[model samples]
Target: MYSDDIAIRVNNLSKCYHIYERPQDRLKQSLYPRFQQLMGRQPSTYFREFWALRDVSFEIKKGETVGIIGRNGSGKSTLLQIICGTLTPTGGTVDTRGRIAALLELGSGFNPEFTGRENVYMNGSILGLSREEMDARFDDIAAFADIGEFIDQPVKTYSSGMYVRLAFAVAVAVEPQIMVVDEALSVGDIRFQNKCLRRLDEIKASGCSILFVSHSSTMIESFCDSVVWLEQGEIRDSGRPNEVVRRYVDYMAHGVNDSGNKSVFDIGIETEQSSNGWEWIRITDQNNVRALDDYAFKRIRVKVGEEPNASRLPCEPTVIEIECEFLALKPIEFPLFAVGIFNELNEPVIHCNSNNLGTRMIPIVDGQLVTCHFKATIPGLRPGKYLLAIGMDEGLLGAHQLLCHVYDAWVFQVLSPRSGRIQGGYVQVQDATINLQIMKGDRQ
Candidate 1:
């Protein structure tokens, strides 16, 4: 039930998209009236109608934070667009209170021709802020953005990071009653992301309703007060943030990794406590152990959300990608890396890009994000606490070199599952494939 203090109410809102047979049908529909009079309402040339959203409804309290999640193409973006007044709903309506500020994309409202100062003022006006009002908040905005002297420089000349800093600063400064944030927050460095998160928390404390959409479940769990899940344009679950995200992660891991069959639904994730939360070991390599003197490749450690790794994997990876909360020594080039898996003797298990998989040719820039995938087809490694080696290796042909370890990383256990199925396996790679046929009807 939506209490009297509700700030937004969405009732049976839906959006439909028509798939056209030919590209020209769009133009025809726009001008169909001129020639369709003789035909008395010609049937739509497009043969398909896809409902991007179906019978979706939710209510937000005055200062509640809501998270929206679904697989790609599940209408998450469309719903946000409708709420932000960027797109119209095919059915139903969204009722909201007060002015709204949206950061659907970084620099969406920027004019490349203008300096950051001018764009800030112009975007502020568009968001309903007056000159005097913006001027009063300008100092706070600039200090929060911390983009140096670039605020007076043309937006076109700003780096991607600088642009994001400025755009986000302005949006938060305008002080709208409702604010919508998309995944663009993933682009910035860790420090900036943390700053933004703190500001968002401050805004929430100030009684502003916020809507957030991100692929990372950890981010959702740590941030949103409540969560809503959408599947194939329909609402699947709406309630606690912890419950919904666990389901989404389960849905993503099914078939690719392990799935708990006891649940009625496919995408439900079961939670349990852990020591610092390092359960599944992802990186592996037994060879190329770094001696204390090996300094060919500089070591680059990882920090969550920026630096080398994120706190959570964007998707339910076949292998468990551990959280990185620390970094190593001084900065190197652009592609520092950490690899983990099983090692022989003391060798690292996996590489920056495994050469055997033809991925070794790719150079890993220092602190760049690289996801190393593995096939868990061969199981039965002796169970114990195994260490996943984090290090730098020079790939084949020196195409790109992995300098060194950002951190020593952590360890995980391989235990036995009850059903004779291997337990603690990181991936769900098919164990075997079998085919049977009746030979010349003899069996029959």
Candidate 2:
């Protein structure tokens, strides 16, 4: 039994569909199962079972807002449909308390032949409201939809935006205790979207539980109290919004597997000792090295505020140290040392090169090791994992020959305390200041 405070309880909820290779296979499967059963033989199957959701379970407390995030075909929509009672589950059950309303796919819960005003009444009736009650709320619904005279036109004549507006209006007008929204707000204009968000905020304030499915991490982080990440019809992770969203972003950007063991950006490096006169290696034998014949990265290390993994503040001073060595038959001059920081998306966030900074490495002999250190205050980085790439090159800007380079040599995480200001986008602008100024008009 679920506690009284729980708004929704999903227990091992699963949905499966039979996928037949051909249309005839479906009929064959249906008839063969019964025929085999009658013959006292094992049931024959002509179709494969496709599970859209498998053994998913979670609970949402009353008045809580939860966000669902996942890639395409991840069963986010299927789960929402099952929770809203529009689709039946193949296994397990979902128990929900209080009235539930959903804004699902575009034009859902709306009839094309019915006018917008008429459809509102129809949807209201489905939500357990009387015609008299709907009439009392009709003006408020129309005003919220803001479709004006278009409310008199058939839904078939409405655009996607208008359809969403009317659907959202009806869903919220019933004053549901539980609300499910699946990317419907994304179709409206920016202004209308803000208005809808404000309305959702008011609803949330009124102790309504909400299930929001959106692709934008910013939206999830901003509005959701908790988050669930789904992949391949299974729950990948579920927890606080910041933590789950960060992991989801990392998985999406770096292709991190569900097991969290394989990293797409990880490359094998060679670091074995050699008796040859010139050998390329990593500074630490423990680190894997992918070395080139002429150049190699010896080691890479990062430190934030004297701590290895405690980068709690965005404005903290961070240090990156790279040790490299080159084996040359003759003397080499003006080698360039560079280090770049990339976010989970593999996009460069910070790049620094000795040549660009007017600092050149000393002339090198046959087997000399060079160490480069970089120190800077990291601009506010969104709370997520990042990578460091290091390289050595031969000339100045625009005409440099890459001797050797290692991508994603080191991985690090930024841990910023949760705050509304730090939730969106990749970078947190530290020391940002804003001022408003006014100039007096000359004309009267």
Candidate 3:
């Protein structure tokens, strides 16, 4: 028996494949096994057993989104395929309720010879949609895909992005009770990806469960209600997205090291890889002299604590200190310094500058090394990795000449708060005080 509230349940699920040394070995195993069985003898094994997943178990509640993360061969895809019923599990049982729409491999159910229009109908039928139902939704699906006239053309002529566009369009149009997505969305353009994300948000809001798999920590932490971390085909950890993702990242960066005891940021004076080691991959280029504009970032250093830059709790009072040196090739005046802290998605979550703070800097002469320091308190940012960027410009805020700028200048981590979990959003308001005034009133 299965509960109505449980969208998916897997118990002791395992999948194994036979690894043959050669083509002849596969043939021999198929023939010899049957011959041994017929002769009343034990079958001789001719292949090695490779267990892709072993004793994996979990539950996805109705309307809850879960994220699965692991290394390349950590069996993420295998697990998803089993849950989607495309691959049979060698052992254990999987029970799922309601209609399932999945975007597995790129063009998995698509036929190269069939037109995009034809494949959409075929996929819809596979998802338990009637011909009439698909007919009603076909125009909307075609418009969402935005492939234009290519919808009538063969699927083989479409690019990888186009295939995903059409497939995602069809999948979402089904309005399934459960949505399973692999990393196929990564192939689409930013606009299409955003569109898909918006659609997914709508699905989730409608009480549909989602199983998302991605290598991006930012996406998983921001999108998932819960996360499952798999290691070597087994469940390593499962719980809140922030905690699980932090552990996973720590292990990936420094395996077997006591992550709890060690700090992620090391601000030593002369360490092998100091904060100053970050190279400035300039984003802007110009053939004119303005691009060459006599200014260059020489070095940068960030300090979060006296010991080292370690994980911080939410709502913790954090003072970010930045020291940077620059070489001014020309005379610079009223230099404005900006420090930006970006999240994993490269979105600026925190931006502070001297101009905003009303701190005016003195003028600088050519061939001079200008050193500046910046200090600011970071609000209650959600637990995740953050990157630091620095920018220097001469003149006023509205109109200024770019002197130098470098992104990913430094890195830091924010751990979950001990008192409570600050869920969702980029930054939380610090030290908030609530004053409730109760007034007598009558219900009208």
Top-lDDT candidate index: 3
**Count of residue pairs whose backbone atoms collide, per candidate:** 27, 6, 0
Model 3 stretches astray by more than 4 angstroms:
37-40, 256-444
**Which structure is stronger by lDDT: 1 or 3?**
3
TM-score for each of the candidates: 0.57, 0.70, 0.64
lDDT of 1 by residue, 321-362 (tens): 333222224333433334555421222334443444454334
lDDT per residue for candidate 2 within 209-231, as digits (tens), equals: 99999998878888999888988
The digit string of per-residue lDDT tens for model 3 on 101-209 reads 9999786979999999999999988888899999999999999999999999999999999999999999889999999999988899889988999999999999999
- List clashing residue pairs in candidate 2: 269-289, 269-290, 270-289, 270-290, 282-298, 283-298
Q: Model 2 Cα displacement at 444 (Å)?
A: 14
Cα error of candidate 2 at position 261, Å: 14
Q: Give the TM-score of candidate 3.
A: 0.64
lDDT of 1 at 308: 29
| Candidate whose TM-score is highest | 2
